[model samples]
Target chain A: MTVLAVAEHRRGDLRPVSYEVVTAGREAADATGGDLHLAVIGGDVESFAEDLNREGVDAIHTVAVGEEFDHGVYAQALTQLWADVEPSLLLAPNTVNGLDYAPAVAERLDIPLVTDAVGVDAGEELVVTRELYGSKVETTLAVDADRAAVTVRPSEWAAAEGHGDATIEPFDADIDESALGARVTGFQEVGGGDVDIGEADVLVSVGRGIEEEDNLDIIQALADALDATVSASRPIVDNGWLPKDRQVGQSGKVVTPDVYIAIGISGAVQHVAGMKGADTIVAINNDPNAPIFDIADYGIVDDLFDVVPALTAEFQ
Target chain B: MKVLVTVKEVAAVDDEFEIDGLAIDDRYLSYDLNEWDEYAIEAAVQISEAREDVEVVTVTVGGPDTEETIRQALAKGADRAVRVWDDAIASAGLLDPATKATVLSAVVEEEDPDLILTGVQAADDGFGATGVTLASAIGWEWAAVVNSLDLDTEAGVASVHRELEGGVEETTEVDLPAVLTIQTGINDPRYASLRGIRQAQSKELAVQSLSDLGLDAGALDSPMEQTSLYEPETEGEATVYEGSAEETAGELAALLREKGVGEA
Candidate 1:
């Protein structure tokens, strides 16, 4: 038995979670006394698979195929792969692509499905843990099924590198074209320049308290000083103050970083779902009663204009 | 063109949530219209106010609880309301929301709307797959995350201004009978009018169920699978380093360097 870690990619660039997933898969494989298998499925995934290879007892499986994630195709191929490999545990990132086909795979195999997991441990029965209810609580679940598939949240595990010249192998399956009923005729890739949120080390997020579009300069100045990315609550994006790429919420990009400094924002549940995975959550909001303060590891109550400038000057 | 927009009744975007073993405590949740769906409705109303033939209607999928969301839409001036309740689909063992979207798309196809709109993403799943999935289910031309729209019934085209990264906006002109996933910032969703608030109760709401869509809840394919729930590892402590500007700047740079930036 082995633990399979599924990697995510957009237009072929590997998602940072590939490292984190391997870190997670290694843990599961270690406890169950099995190997770790890293699977990359998409077009042009060879270079990505090699980068994610680990020496933790097993091989890397690359499902390089003509199919670019047709749900039925992925589901059927994964189901067959899991059956052939008979892994003790399977792990995937809790991502759009992962969520797309993971359930179908679980449903086909009759395995317990656990998602948005923060931690996992080995035991007589595998214990998968996830944050529940908007970062307010931690639920550690002892999955009731013998065979289990899980999607691990990104950034939770710092992928620990071990020594190995790990071997790479390509996975070829006889994909039934009929199963791939829906084909992606074209894809709109979110263009790049600064790092994607998943890979950012630090993020300075502004909430509704940012007040006006003019106030963003001080926030950007602060981000510039800190070399951090600028992000915001839905209100800012919805107000056309910023692009949708900057929106961080349940309806936006879920990000995990080393440091997340929230400024002038009330923590709404929607916003919390996205950034709850951050390592150090520092909230800067005037309202003590603001929902943001509840999940903030550290809190600052003051005017954002004054506070943000002070922080910017300090960082500069 | 009476535009009928569909919204979903989901765990509120603001509700406090808790998970006790297998059960999620939904008490803190307030059922409201999906935020992005509200934009679609708001856009429809704006079009109706500008055009003579257009009137906005609100449609939703859920159990009886969905009726409240419909009422809110009515209170905001939707001319009519329809509720499709497939209690079986509403109550299924599968954890996929796409299953719901699949059922919804099949039902929506029968309504024959000149154009259909949804939010770019739903708050609950944040999967952002519903609108695209619905479009595929019906085989309609689809454009996602549109910040603006202009409906031209004459040439049979819907002009959409799409939001992209780097503050880029793409203007797309799709032929009529298309699906648009409304982006945020389309317009502020309007509040209910007092006259309309009172009239909401008087509005005739036609309620249907999954049976009406001719869907056997079991036949739908649930694509996404979940494995287990794990709490995120806590990000380490972030102690505020308060000091003079010079001291803090020096400290901040040292910290960044320690994290391996500017090391080379």
Candidate 2:
């Protein structure tokens, strides 16, 4: 058995999830008693190969196709690589770009593909553990196939580090330019506004628990009382209650505030990805079983409508 | 021109719920149209409203119980609805993305729609792969996590802005006759009006089974099996404060002061 893990990059730099993918692939490879092979497509493959040469990696394959990701090019190149490598398991990141191409590769190869796996084990069978119903519950799926593909959830595994002596090889993927149906035009930076939540020392982040847009006044009042910056989860920004600059999540700004007070936030995984690095975390929600409490250092299980005003008074 | 939107009826568990065997108890679950699919439906409806001779049809893989949810899409301005269900589908256990793409591709074959839209991921299972998988199965173009779409049917191109991680958007152009997985915030989803609800009651809703779509029960066959379901153990060692709102707030305030918060 062999495990092939693909590295992800955007613009000019490799995303941090690429190292995490190597870690996940090494674990699967260890379980199956096989060697781990890494592949980096497009955008500075020579440098990416050198950087991806982690300790557990047995070999590195570089496919120099284009400067950036084109799903059509990826689908064709990965299929050709799959035919050559014939690995038992294929691992890819569960990023936006990964979702863009992994499905097509798996579908073209006629293999079972599981996305957003938090846990992967390859013993007698492949078992993948993932969250359902928005992280309210976890379920384990057993794949009854000899070969399968899995897209690993980011930040679940620690990054692979240290140097290795893996052999580097270049594979010629003759990508058909005419077969490409989609073309990348350009990239733009969104979320530029009056505030940069990333620099705040203290943040008062709100979520769907705020109920209505008009109710954001209480959150604002609380933030004002504590002299903290106002941030929000995806819903508030999606509702246009706050500008995109104030949103904190995977697609938003990653903030590492000193004191993070989560008011009415249930702490979904995507939202957690941004603020989990805060020094001290507090959660105020009515539901005790909310996942927010699982990471909070101090939690008050009460309605935000009652607690916000009361907590605001304490600071004032 | 025609647009096909994939809608799913997702089950959301209550704050406190019980897990019965490998699934949550029905008593503690409530069904609603997936959040992401709502955006997809709105995108399709907007396209229909903007052009001439355009029809927006919704396809769902659920039983009769989902008709009410499907009607919500019709009420939101979809022209019609298609529900694909069968006993084989019900007993298939886990309807993986591949199985779903297989089933939905058959409908694409029959409908021959020029554009297909689906949510980036279903709120329930969150597979986030069916739209792309279906596109590959049918050999059509696709884009994922699209937050903005500018479709020109005359030019056969759909310009989109894909929401990448860390506040970056990638602009891309996908050829028409493509499947784009819509992300939230693409557009404001409108609430169904009372008049629209009444019209939706009389709208056409056609149900098809595997055989009806020229597929057998084998189409539901999948290699994935859900073995267990359980709530993850809480890992936090937080010192939860117990008391009234005033009491808890007082405790938190003292701690915040100790941590040097709220000092001018």
Summarize candidate 2's per-residue lDDT along B1-264 as a digit string, tens digits. Answer: 999999999999999999999989999999999999999999999998888999999999999999999999999999999999989888888999999999999999999999999999999899999999999999999999999999977799999999999999999999978999999999999999999999999999999999999999988889999999999998988789999999999999999889888887
Cα-based lDDT at residue B66, candidate 1: 79
Against the native chain B, each candidate's TM-score is 0.82, 0.99
Instruction: Give residue B71's lDDT in candidate 2 (0 to 100).
Output: 96
Please, what are the lDDT tens digits per residue for candidate 1 over residues B1-264?
Answer: 757576776664233344444445557566667778888888888888888877676677667877888888888877787787666756664434346556666667666677777777655545455565565556565566777788888887787766643244555566667767787788988888888789999998887766677777664544332444433454435344455534544455555555643333
Docking class of 1: incorrect
Q: Residue A281 of model 1: what lDDT?
A: 79
Model-by-model lDDT, in order?
Answer: 0.68, 0.94
Model 2 scores a TM of 0.99
lDDT of 2 by residue, A195-274 (tens): 88999999999999999999999999998998999999998888888988898989999999999999989989999999
lDDT of 1 by residue, A157-269 (tens): 87746655566777676687653433344444344445566678888888778888898888888888778888888789788787767877755688898878888777755
Query: Where's the lowest-lDDT run of ten residues in candidate 2 chain A?
Result: A188-197
Off by over 4 Å in 1: A66-90, A99-114, A120-128, A138-149, A163-167, A175-205, A210-231, A243-261, A266-282, A286-298, A302-316, B1-6, B10-29, B40-66, B74-204, B208-264
DockQ list for all candidates? 0.15, 0.89
Candidate with top DockQ is 2
| Each model's backbone clash number | 25, 0
